[model samples]
Target: MAEGLRTAYQLEEDDIATILPEEEDKFNGEEFNKQFLQFDRDRIQKINQKGKEKFEQGYSKAKKEVLDQLETEARERFGVEDDELRGIDLIDHIVEINSKKSKADPTKLTEEQIKSHPSVIKLLNEKEKSFKTREEELKTEYDTKLNNFQKERTFSAVEKKALAIFDKMNPVLSSDPERAANQKSILINDLKGLDYQEDGDTYIPLQEGKRLEDPHGNGVSFEKLVQSRAARYFDFKKAEERDTPPAGGGDGGATGFPKTEAEYAKIVNDQNIPLEERLEIKKKWNEAKSQS
Candidate 1:
């Protein structure tokens, strides 16, 4: 029975072997599984590397196509072409060409050509306008300087004439330089309100508005006005009176009582007399006159 059982199991094994092919003795199932997994990994890695290379090539081609399109558009629009220049460089070149054309000489062109070039006409018009403006400015400057010079000359002439009138009116002023200067200044100020009439090449001082008359009811001359006004402001005496010695003082020219009109005049005209003594002398003169 054991022998028969062994034979039956062998037959079953033979039948299984026929259905499933047996591997060679050197083939290991575990090792073959490992090798198959490694091969799949290497294949996937190669596919990924090929895909990356294709993507890089596509990107480079797209970038070159875009740059070429831009250059074509720029050249067509600007009417300029250069293989070495692209984008902004092409634009700058076009601007330089147009600038040169704008600056072209109108003198070398025909009338019709010059009229057609409006930029040249505009530049010439602007230059002409600038020249006219400069001319107007120079004229204005010259007129202003001439006006100022005329004003100065007129003022100097007026002052010189005023000083001469003042000197003639007051002989005291001629000897005293400081007093002469002061009186001339005052006379000039008074004359500032007067009008001036053109007299030959010079001007004559004429009174304006309300005219002033002297005590004799006659129109006052400039000289008479200066003399009267000076007398009003200053106490002027004859030069001889100022130099003469006082009388009746025991040979010392000291002030004393006055007996006559000349003695009284001398005492009063003497500036060296004390104010109190002068007052006393005046009181004595009044008393003597009353008693008579």
Candidate 2:
């Protein structure tokens, strides 16, 4: 019976072997598992190293390209040489002098010693003076250019408002040649309302005075309305005079008459002016035309 049992077990082993390859002689299951884990860790480390190397290479290339482009642009746009653009070499000289001083005996730094190191002192002084000179030059250039730009293109809101008021008064004033001529000085005097005491050039509207409460209850100056009207008239007259060039280069010139009586009638009909003043201006205009 024991012999029969051994034969049956051997036959079963043979059948299993025939169905599958024999277990690998070198396969220690636990050792193989540990080896697989170490293989994975090594692969991960290699991948990280490659990634870091690529990142470093890209960064270095970008930095070099950017620096080269900046240098090229500076040279092209500003005519700055590489040496000049690198900044003054005085700093290197200063560092050298400071280093030497650090090594020298502090107690022995006499006037003679300082004078002997004249090159360092001269370089320091030259650097300071050159910096100051360059700063002053830049400031002056900026101010000059800014002023020219302002003069050519800038206008304050007050100036624009004043000009608009002047335009509105133009036709009325131009209608009466005699009144425009005779009262021109008075009209100029009336412009005092437009003149703010601040910078003395700006003109705010007369309505702005309503905002201020006077302690004496004096209220808004009644003169403001008269002044504004007169100022507008005067500005128009001045513009017209400028447009009408002097004949024969002298103050005495022919007064150009209005083309028609209807033109003068328009000023006589404007409602903004006092009825009495409008009528008076019209009468004077008629008299001037009759004399002409």
Candidate 3:
């Protein structure tokens, strides 16, 4: 119940467990709580009220269904309309919405039948327009940002000297666009922080401290951080690629895909993997549904 309530209200269970109890014991209830801790009387009252309600309701089926849906949406973690999985649910959603009409129609409805339905077709067309508009927005924004960054000459010295060292050190970063961007950003920051001497067409890099902040803000060597994280991103990107199915639907062959929707749901709900990565896996999962 404690964990469930924490999740339902987006409370930090670890924060409460580690910090709240200690603070409670350390101070008297009559004394004012510290503002930084964010554990004021009203907050605690709200949590207690919700807990009382949940306890009285006893996790009813209606509440369970709502919670399940909220949990699923949270897991979906849908980002901007990437072209790859562009509105895969439009067909399913439309079919569900027009189930009665579909049943009464003489024509046998195929999985792709939504393509022919007037309403479905219209919605899809509009979504495509939206996709294009969003794409253009992204492109214009990216170009503007890139131009500004270039004009600033923020990384010119890094590009001159340490870029070669960075390339030699973090080659795995080149495999994916996101990884490449992250590596570039980190290396530029790392190099800029370093003390450098100007030479002919090159730079001599030095710094008093031997360590630069890792991308995660912990201390580590730039080479070490890039080597470790680059390898991880490479593996993750490769797995993402291998998992993506061809848009023509699942291949007319077996490929170790999840055999049932239940299995797919289990995988999709997995909180261990990154949410975006899990969503990509859900996109590629076979459409098989479990008997249960």
Instruction: Report the number of the highest-lDDT candidate.
Output: 1
Decide which is better by TM-score, 2 or 3: 2
Where's the lowest-lDDT run of ten residues in candidate 2? 249-258
**Residue-level error in angstroms, candidate 2, position 161:** 1.0
lDDT pick, better of 1 and 3: 1
What lDDT does model 3 reach? 0.46
CA lDDT of every candidate: 0.53, 0.44, 0.46
Query: Which residue ranges in model 2 land beyond 4 Å of their true spot?
Result: 1-116, 147-156, 169-292
lDDT of 1 by residue, 214-239 (tens): 67867665556556655654444564
Residue lDDT tens for model 3, 1-292: 2353365334566644543343222433333234313643455477557755654454343344444443344234322222332234534544544666447442456757657767666655654565556556655655675555443332443453444454444244453545655666664664455544444654444457343455686655444543554454343333333444445554322122355667566655443333444544554553332322
When superposed on Cα atoms, how far off is each prediction in RMSD? 53.8, 39.4, 31.6
Ranking by TM-score: 1, 2, 3
Sort the predicted structures by lDDT, highest score first.
1, 3, 2
